[model samples]
Target: MKYQIRHRTHYRYTQPLRSAVQTLCLTPRHTDTQHVHHWQLQSPTPLQPQTDAWGNHSHVLAVGAGARMLQCEATGMVETLGTPLQSDPLGPDPRLYLMPSALARADDALRRSALAAVRGVEGRQAQALALTALVAECVRYQPGRTNANTTAAEAWLGGVGVCQDQAHVLVAACRAVGLPARYVSGYFHARGGPELASHAWAQVCLDPAERRWLGLDVTHGCVVDERHVQIAVGPDYAACAPVRGVRSGGGGEQLTVSVEIIPQD
Candidate 1:
């Protein structure tokens, strides 16, 4: 399947910002399951492209003084293989994902729930699926209840959050049981109502030696498929956020994001 994706983000601030520097992870990743044909980014300033420590394609955008508004757009074409399970022969060591990040640290209650979910599961894939179901059941998809900084422990305890929270809980749960799992940020093409085009999921490493992984969408309680396009993989959402920046001075800001994923074929 081929897709044309457009993502636009705009920011309005009450006060002009003196200066700002942003890190962007908006580019889709070239992996065994997907191939990037062409990708372009448009911003107020020039973008410096670089690969992050986790091998994700990223960019650095710098804005000078007296900026009251900021807009960034990304357009791309990609082809997906529609394979939910894949092996990353050239990715970072799978062991690196075993330790949960701060935003995905599992608490004692979470650990116990994870253990009970996979207690009788046999294969790694089955256990991962069980965990995915557990996350979906434990965390109802409720937007506005959690923000970007919400942690897995908090979301699980509250039992309400969006896809990001679900992914964090899944990653934390997988790591609690000695399985290596990484957070995935991407785009999802939904056929109908309410689901955001911008999505998040988890990829569990089944065989570290073989670099085999299974992509799980805890929000939908299923494996990732052709509708999903990979963007970045990291320990948590903070590491793979589409855009993160700091400015010298910007009082009260409002942000708007629009994402469109059209099927080309």
Candidate 2:
């Protein structure tokens, strides 16, 4: 499947930024399973986009005017090649170590929740899919409610989180249960779907016959379809991001983001 995306962002400042520095994570990344056919960003100032120390492509834009309007527009097409391997119980990949924080409590509420979802599932693939269903049934995929800083504990307890938060919790829970899991930031075009909103999910690697990374969207409670566009994969949230940056322009006083994702039928 091929998907075309159009994204627009507008920022209205309460006060003229004096001088502002803004970081953008709006760029859709291209990968083996994804391609960027066309892309653009329209801003009030020139964009000094560069690969950051972290190696993710970043957009660093500075506004000369104190108060100004910032707009970002981007369009691209990506294809899902279907993963080379999915749900491999025993692949050549190394074992994934879990973070202590992600598994701090052996009987934490969230761990219990994930276990309940896969009680009867013997293999990692089936268990991961079951957990995805649990998350989707447990929470709603609403944006603007949570952010990158939102804690996994809060999201799990609240039963509500944006895509990022949900992915974080799902991955953490998987790790907590001795499964190797990573976070994925990408775009998902549902079946006969519109260009998808900014989306994130998790991939778990369980040893046995299933060493392949299996994609699961707890936020949507479904396995990946053609709509999934993977940007990067990493052990945690900070890694595998499309874009990230620092603010040298006096913190910018304020910031806002607007994104419009449309899929070409």
- Strongest candidate by TM-score: 1
- Summarize candidate 1's per-residue lDDT along 158-202 as a digit string, tens digits: 999999999999999999998999999998876554445689999
Error of 2 at 61 (Å): 2.4
Single out the weakest 10-residue window by summed lDDT for candidate 1: 188-197
lDDT of each: 0.91, 0.63
Lowest lDDT 10-mer window, candidate 2?
88-97
TM-score of each: 0.95, 0.71
lDDT of 2 at 232: 53
Q: What would the per-residue lDDT of candidate 2 be over residues 1-265, giving only the tens digit for each residue?
A: 6666666666655555456566765565554445677667676778887654323455777767555455566566666666623443222342543553431222388888877777878887777777777767776677677767676677777778788877877777777777777777777665655445667888777553434567887766666666677655555566554434432233333444444445565
RMSD of 1: 1.5
Off by over 4 Å in 2: 52-55, 65-67, 82-97, 100-107, 115-123, 140-149, 191-196, 206-212, 232-258
